[model samples]
Target chain A: MQLSDSLNQLIEALRCQPGIGPKSAQRIAFHLLERDRKGGTQLGSALTKAMTAIGHCQTCRTFCEQPQCDICLSTKRQDSGTLCVVESPTDVLAIEQTGQYLGLYFVLMGHLSPIDGIGPKEIGLDVLEQKLSQGGINEVILATNPSVEGETTAYYIAQLCHKNNVGASRIAHGIPVGGELDLVDGRTLMHAFSGRRVVTQE
Target chain B: MQLSDSLNQLIEALRCQPGIGPKSAQRIAFHLLERDRKGGTQLGSALTKAMTAIGHCQTCRTFCEQPQCDICLSTKRQDSGTLCVVESPTDVLAIEQTGQYLGLYFVLMGHLSPIDGIGPKEIGLDVLEQKLSQGGINEVILATNPSVEGETTAYYIAQLCHKNNVGASRIAHGIPVGGELDLVDGRTLMHAFSGRRVVTQE
Candidate 1:
């Protein structure tokens, strides 16, 4: 707080990051100005360019610089019948890293939270409904997390797909693949039990 | 890495921060663009301003916005006879925060490592020698950390002060104030015993 006005301002602005606090902000600001001013300038200009150029993809609501995201336009990822619906663009990246599931995506960006007045339309659910009604997608995989808001949003999307005559399924909620039995939480255990599967002999 | 081009560029540039890696950089970039683009813009502009405006103080080599740093220009801190020579500007801040020392400071910005080609001139030791020759300073306190390079730098500075007829002293190396005896290392314990203070009867 005893730094120059501009430096203090930069530190303050850096705290807008999700996990960054005053100490981290100050450290980052000082590091940028003291050790890497050229990179700092590049970061500043890049920040402006990214913010100014990026917007929601028209088809999936994922962040992109064009009308549609590359994922939506790719012929390589042509599994259009199976769409993975997620809560945010970061989820898209997480799924993309697996190099599996060559399908389209729908980024809600947020779940339906009635108390905060974030309803279906606020997160582009209308766009999703329109896509479903167009009769191309055969299965809608609800990849939203198992929290209350996420569950509610998934249920609403599922009901919408059912009304539109498209198959809808929620992503399974259970113990993680590499999880230990004793370490798993109660809710996860319950879901894992409820979602039990049987092995078939061919 | 599958993020949009500008977002990926921003993430890559964020790696220039001292301790940040790919994961934290991506999280920071996504957080900035997704939830706080306005703040991102402010931070970008603030970086440009701070980088453009800040310069080293002529006398102390500490960051400043003008010809000299605030500490160097302040008339209240007039104990120019007792000077603290430290390795970096952060060291000056640390000493100033204690509110115990009231003296001018000289920041070297780095230690003296001869093999790496960082000799006296690289760290502006000649400028310090010139200051010492001016005859206003009476005692020079070396507050460098207790390390091979730091001790060497301190010894070299102490010799310069001694040659100029000025008193030279080093900050003590001992067990930290709240350190537990069992947890402290052997070398620190040895220093604690060596620098033991005498008890005076009340």
Candidate 2:
């Protein structure tokens, strides 16, 4: 569209983000230019600051501005014999949103997909195994997504944890909440039926 | 969602851009952390560089890293008494995409919406008029969008240009090419039929 060089550059940069296609990037770049000049400056500063300041947390492999993320550093969090393992920080956020899991996390940073060249080493599985072998975690929850890659990754992790003498289990796979059987995809519906838990409530 | 503090901060910063809702911001933040760390770093640098380096071109109000935008500086562009006046730099880009116009630009920076407290002064219309009166630009094309605010701003500028003895005309509003008459909305169809131009052959 022949945008000014600077605006074009900004749009190109923003397009690096997943799901932010060219049109959205252009719209965002122009909108930033039109309004909130100070906010634009702040956005730029934040981007640079975040890139420079944040790094993988040494304990959990989650992005952290500090040496250890707040979640990893907090003593108030249940440091019991339970650890929840997930594929990424986004998964960590999703689990945290439930307000159910009280244990610490061990972010894998990625899933194991042989097709994409992501192996156990690529996803920091060796580190996870080391943590499990240290013998503090009694229950290891494999909370990776229900996708094939995620399942394979979870299974591998669970097998390794079992070999290291740590208890491990995968999160249940089923239809999402608010999903109707008719509306749910065939694969998900099948999974939901197969993994159905017995109702105990009267 | 209990995101890591750094990730949350990054999302908050990204929310400044228009059309970036909380979910999209969160997705972008997480994607930056998950994949393409190098691309993320480049994006960060580009954002900082563009924000710190670019500013409004003094002449045309378009974004520029230098005193004047490249378009304004280019001697090759025909400054042949034609000036395309637009609401913003994005509008300039839209017009440029047509590749039919061979003229300079006068970016209004915003529309004239009194209810919203945006006046002619706010949009730099005074500066535009001043430039017109300097005897270089004979024709000013009002290329604002076909909206109430855009119409109000265009009419206001046209009146100013007429009073100052400069030629001004509104850009055509019609259904897009390749769009079906039946599929087109009522307002657009009406405008298209009304504004239909006479066919000509050499």
Candidate 3:
């Protein structure tokens, strides 16, 4: 039997979520309508508000309601001299969750995908370059993934940092912790070996 | 770095989707805000509209924009004396997709989960009893599953049918199509064997 027009439309609309298929969309739609009406409104209001209120942080390019993100504005964090450059705001969150990196961040939002017409300008490289050129930043830690596009983007950003007289470093690539050697990919092992650190005598 | 207030709120609100955890919620929140703004708005508006407009079908208890669901109102479907009773709205959709059962449906929404304080009245068995007494349904197809709670609920409804002088039939329980016998559960196999039908000479 055909569902009501609104329900069908809602089900169709829910497919907008990443990884959501027809079955998942229908399930989510029904779950929202039948079980959590209040939560549905909260999600709706949040989406509506985020669409209008959320934008790029002026200094870091991360998503935030204000012009600058919380990381960029916080004086309690480590000195802004060391900046971590990443592919997306999610990457920033991942690093922050470690509780290790207390410095600031620069989110590129996307890599330099030339095939898709996504160039340096598309990811606001000019703005990042301008910030680097102003010259207080001492080092740039390129924390992009080990993919080809990530390497290229990191290299490009590194060149920009060099021209601005700022030190640049790429994050080490290696097999994940708790990963077995046999299960590790060959390329990752190669990277881990090449980037291995030397032990110092006591 | 802590996400902005709106972003955090959105991530929190997105956990309303069934099976979505903190990680999936964060991914979905970022996916909507960063990449699919228009689609996010569509989902949001759809969710909002559905929360207000969608309600229980007076006849079948399935969700619908109108007082009666489309299945309950359709003129093309068979107006036979048969009525199919399912455990949930998803079940109704599942059965409807088969395009086989031409009869009307009555959704119980849940089984008799006594531990959860769900009794016959909680799942609207009283209303179903009232409908049965009005006297148009000649046969009730108890399509509820063969699980403990489902069996109990079906038995209760079946008794209601007998009181109203209506025929009650349970959907056959057997190994699923394309299922191997070795993988089939013991109880299901036993039911399949006990309920086996005799072959007629063609």
Candidate 4:
């Protein structure tokens, strides 16, 4: 039997999510209608509000409802004079959860990919250059992922930082803390060995 | 760092979907904001419209925007005098996809589970009884799931149909087509043996 138009529309629309497929979309639609109408209504309003209202921060390009993000507006982070560059807003969240970094973030929103036509401007590198040239930031921490595209993007940003006479350092690439040495990939092992630090220089 | 209020709320509201966790919610939120704002907006409006407008069909108790679902209103299905009772709307979709079972459906929405406080009335059995007593249905197919609760519910509904002088039959349960006997679960194998049909009469 044909589903109602509204239900069918909702199911079709749900395919916009990253991993959901047709079956999953239908399941989710039925779940909301059968069990969680209140949650569905709340999600609808939330999606509407976020989609229309949320935009990139003027300074950092991370998602925000206002002109600037919270971290960018904070005086403490500003005083630190260190900028952490990353590929996405979720990376900002991951770093923030660590509570180790006290600096503003410049979210690239995506990595540089020449094949897909994504470049400096597409990932907002022009904005990053402007931020670097403005001269408040003493250092830039490239925290992009370890993927090839992420590396290319980080290297490009590092070049920009150097051109502006700012110190740029990449986040370490090594085996995870709890990961077994044998399980680590060749590249990671090589990087770990090459970048090893002397704990006790006796 | 604290996400913007709208962004955070969107993430939280997204967790209402089955199988979505906090991390997936955040990922989906960022994905929508970054890549598919138009799709997200469409989904939001569709969700809002569906959640508010769709209601249980008065005839079959299935989800629809009208008093009667399309299948129930169809003259062909109505004339069949066969009503298939199921546990959810998705089951109706599944049955319909097969191009078989061209009959009306009564969605129970759930099965009887007294431990969880779900009773016959909760699954819309009263409405089903009313439909049965109205004197047009010749047979009621118990297509509820084969679980214990489903069996109990089917038995209850079958008794109701008997009282209303309507025929009741349970859907067959056995090994799936193309399923190997060795791989089939013991219960299913037992069912296959017990419910064996005489294909040819010597």
Best by lDDT: 4
Off by over 4 Å in 4: none
Q: Point out where model 2 deviates above 4 Å.
A: A1-4, A70-79, A196-202, B1-4, B70-79, B189-202
Rank all candidate structures by their TM-score, best first, as comma-separated numbers: 4, 1, 3, 2
TM-score of each: 0.94, 0.89, 0.94, 0.96
lDDT score at residue B6, model 4, on the 0-100 scale = 92
Tens digit of lDDT per residue, candidate 2, span B20-96?
88998888877876666667777777777777777888999888777887777767564577888898887787878
Report how far residue B193 has shifted in candidate 1, in Å: 1.9
Best by TM-score: 4
Worst 10 residues of 3 chain A by lDDT: A71-80
> What clash pairs does model 2 have?
none
Over B71-182, each residue of candidate 1 has an lDDT whose tens digit, in order, gives 8877766555888988877778778889898888888878999899899988889999999999888899999878899999999999999899999999988889888899
Model 1's interface RMSD: 2.0
Model 4 C-alpha lDDT per residue in residues A95-161, reported as the tens digit of each score: 9999998898999989999999997899999988988888999999999999999999989999999
Candidate 2: tens digits of C-alpha lDDT, residues A1-202: 3455666778888888877899988887777766776777777777766766778888888877667777877775546778898888888878888898778899988788888888898888888888888877889888988888888888898899879988898787777787776888888878878988899998
What's the CA error at residue A91 for candidate 3, in Å?
1.5
Candidate 2 chain B has its poorest 10 consecutive residues by lDDT at: B1-10
In terms of lDDT, the poorest run of 10 residues in model 1 chain A is A1-10
TM-score of 1: 0.94
TM-score of chain A of each: 0.94, 0.89, 0.94, 0.96
